[model samples]
Target: MLRLRKSILTVLLAVFTLLGCVAGPSLSAEKTALVVSVPMEGVVGVSLENYLDEAFAYAAEEKAALVVIGLDTPGGLVTSMRGMSQKILSASIPVAVWVGPPGARAASAGAFLVMAAHVAAMAPGTNIGAAHPVTASGQDVPDKELSRKITNDLAAQMRSLAEERGRNAEVAASMVLNSVSLTAREAMEIRVIDTVTPDLPSLLKWADGRKVRVGTVDVVLDLKRYEIRTFEMSPRLRALHFISRPDVAYLMLTLGILAIVFEVLTPGGFVMGTAGAVMALIGAYGLRMLPFNWAGIILLVAGIIVLVLDLVVGGIGVLSLFGLASLVVGSLVLFRAPGGELLNVSVGFMAGITLTLGAFFILAAGAVWRSTRNRVTSGQEGMVQGEGVVVEDLAPGGFVSCHGEVWKAVSEGGERISKGTRVRVVRTDGLLLHVRKVEGENLEEKGAGHK
Candidate 1:
C-alpha cells in the first residue's frame, strides 16, 4: 500500500509540473496591426466623409493598434474638415496620418487632419499645410470679420490638435493663420510631424517600439510583422459622392431641362417623359445637397417657361428676348458666390448654352414661319380652282364630283347648271362651290338634254 501511494504522488506531481510549463506567462510582447488608408485626391467632398466614416468604424471595431491614413487632399469644406478632425481626436486607437508617395500634399483641411492624428508622418518629397478657406468654386471671400473669425477658430483647433499629439502647436497655428507649407524634412524638423519615412514598410518599421497614451493609460506599440487591413467606401456612399458635386448637379439639371423640352415638343413619347422625370428628380436631389440660390432657381424656371411659351405661341419678340436675358442672368447667379471658384457655371459654358438656345429658337421660328406661309394642299380651298363634274340636279345649286367625292354646289352667275354639264368651278362658299358653263358651250341645250 505504501509503494502504490508513492507512485500516485509522483504521477500527480509530474502532471502538475507539465501543466505549469504549458501555461506559463509569456515573455514576448503582444503585437497589433491596424492600417487605414485615406488616399483622397482633388477637392474634398462627400466621398471623403464616407470613406473616413467607414475607416474609423472599422478601426474602432477591430481595436486596432494604430490607424494610418494615407492622405492627399487640396482642402475641402470647413464643415467636413472639422468633422473629420473631431473624429480623429475621439478615436480610442492611436491614429497615424501619413502624407506620402512623393509629391503628395496635405493642403488646407488636410493640415488640420494631420495635426489631429496621434502620430503624424510624411513621406519624402511630400508637403503639408496651406489651410486657407475658400468657397466651393475656389473664390476667396473678402469678409474681414468672417475671415478673422475663421482664422482664429482654425488656428485654435490646430493648436489644440498639435498640443494633444505632442506636435508643434505654434507651427500648426502658423499654417492655419499664415498658409505656411513645409516639406517632409522641414515638417519633421519643426516637430509638425513625428517622422519622415520613404515608404510604408519604413513607416511601420519606424512606428515599432513607439508608445502612445490612450486615456491616461500608456500603451506600447509592437507592430513588427503586423498584418494590414484596408477599408473602402460602400457603393451607396460612393454614389452619393459622385452626385454631390455642383458641376454634376448642374449637368443633371441641364439634362432634365432638355429632356422635358423634348417631351413637350414631341408628346406621347413615354421614353422622353420618363427620362425627364428621372433626370429632374435626380437633379433636384443633387441640388439639394449643394448650397443653392432660390432666386436663381426661380429665374431659371421663369426663363424656361417663357422660352416654352415662345415655342407654343406664335409671338416671340418680347417674351423670347426677356427669357433669353433672364436665362443669362440666372446662369450667372446660379452658384451665388462672390468668388469664381464657387461658380458652377463658367462664362464659357453660359455663352455656349445661350448661343445654342438662340440657334434652336431661330431654327424653330423659321420652321414655324415657313409652315405658316405654305400653300394649302387639301380641303375646299385647295380644290377652288380644280376641275369637277356635275353629278346630279339642274338648278342654281347642284351636286358636283370634286376630288373623287360628291359635293353640294351653287352657280355664282345665277344660271341653271345640268348634270354632266361639264361646268367650270369658279369659287366655293361654306360647302358650296360656284360653277359656270364651259366657254362656247350651249348651256340651254345642255340643260334640256339633261332633263
Candidate 2:
C-alpha cells in the first residue's frame, strides 16, 4: 500500500510539471508589441524630414516592434528625398512604407523612399514610379549630360535598394530611366513590392509572423498581439509645413514687400514696417526650403522699386503700370526651377493678387500725381490767395489777420488799407503778408475780425 501511494504521488507531480512547461511560453508572449504609425503627406521637405526623424526617435525610445510610414506625397526636393531615404535605411527597427488609403501615388522622389523601405506596400487603387528627373518647371532637363548623370545616379540607387530587398532591380531601374508607373497588382506581380493591403489593419495582419532583416539579424514580426499607435506632427512642424508651400511663401513675400514699402512712403507708425519684417523673415525661411529662380526674385524687387519711384517721382501712372507688369512676370517665374513643379502656386491666387495690386498701385499713383499739381496748403506759400480783414489800418505797414492768424502786412502799391477792411493776401515776405483790398468789398459788408 505504501509503494502504490508513492507511485501515484510521483505521477501527479510529473503531470503538474508538464502543464507548467506548456503554459510558460504562451504567458510570456502575451505582452503586446508596440507598432508606431507615422503619416507622411504633402511635399517632402525639411519639415517632413524633421517629423520623420522625431517619429523614429520616439519609436526607438518606446522600443517599438515596427515603424510604419503611411506615405502619400506627390514627390518633392531630391535633397530632402535622399535625407528621408537615409533615415529609413539607418533605422534600428524594421521600417515599412505603405502607399495607402487609395487614390495615392508614390511618384518621383517618393518612389525612391518606398524602395528604400524593408517592406514596401500599397493600397488597391494606388500606383508607384514616375521618378525620371526633370527641371523644377516640369520640363525635361535642358542639359543632356547633366540629365544623363542624374538619371544614371537615380537608376543606380533604385537598383541598389531593389537588389538589397530581393526585388526586381531591372524593373525598379526602369522607373527612373523611363518614368514607368505600375498599379498595385502590377507591382505585386513583378515583385517590386511585398504586399498589396487595402488598409493599415490589413497591412498589419499581413505583416504578422513575417520575418524581416533588421540590421544584420532576421527578426520575425510577432505582431499577432500588436497595438498600433499613431504619431502626429507637432504644431511647430505643422506651421513649418504650411509655410513651406511655394504659394504661401510667395504670397508672404509679396505682402511683406508691399507693407514695408507702405511704411517707407508714409513714415509714421512702425506697425506696417514691423509686420512686414516678420512676414518677410518667415517667407525667407520658406524660400530656403524651396528651389527658387534668382531672376524671379530680382524682377520682383525691381517691380517694387519701380512702384516706389512712381510714388516718389509722381509719374503719370506709367511707372505704376510697368511695375505691375514686372510683378506679374516675376510671380509667374518665382518658383520655376528644377523641382518647381512640386511647388505649385494657384492660378487664381496669382491673377487676383496681380489685379488687386495693380489697381491699388494705379490709384495711389493717381492720388500722388493729383497732389503734386494742387496748390500748397500748409506752408508759407499757403498764405498766398488767403482772405483776411485788417485789425489795424495799414499806413504802409499794419497788422492783418490771415489764415486764422495775425500777420504784419504792407499793401501792394503802398496803398492805405483802412481798419476793418477785408484784404486778399498776394504773397508772403518772411512773416509779413503782401495784401491787396477787394475792389467791391468794404468794412461795412464784411466783419472786421477773423474768426
Scored by TM-score, the top model is 2
Query: Model 2 lDDT vs. the true structure?
Result: 0.87
**How far does residue 163 in candidate 1 sit from its true spot (Å)?**
3.9
Give the per-residue lDDT of model 2 (tens digit) for 309-404. 888888878998899899888877777776543333565686788788888878989999999899998777988999998899999799998878
Model 2 stretches with alpha carbons more than 4 Å out: 11-15, 124-127, 167-192, 292-299, 321-359, 375-383, 386-388, 399-408, 443-451
Model 1 stretches astray by more than 4 angstroms: 1-32, 38-43, 100-105, 123-127, 142-144, 168-191, 196-199, 213-217, 261-266, 314-451
In terms of lDDT, the poorest run of 10 residues in model 1 is 337-346
Q: Note the residue pairs that clash in candidate 2.
A: 135-338, 136-337, 136-338, 136-339, 136-340
TM-score of 1: 0.71
User: Against the true structure, whose lDDT is highest?
Assistant: 2
CA-lDDT, candidates in order: 0.73, 0.87
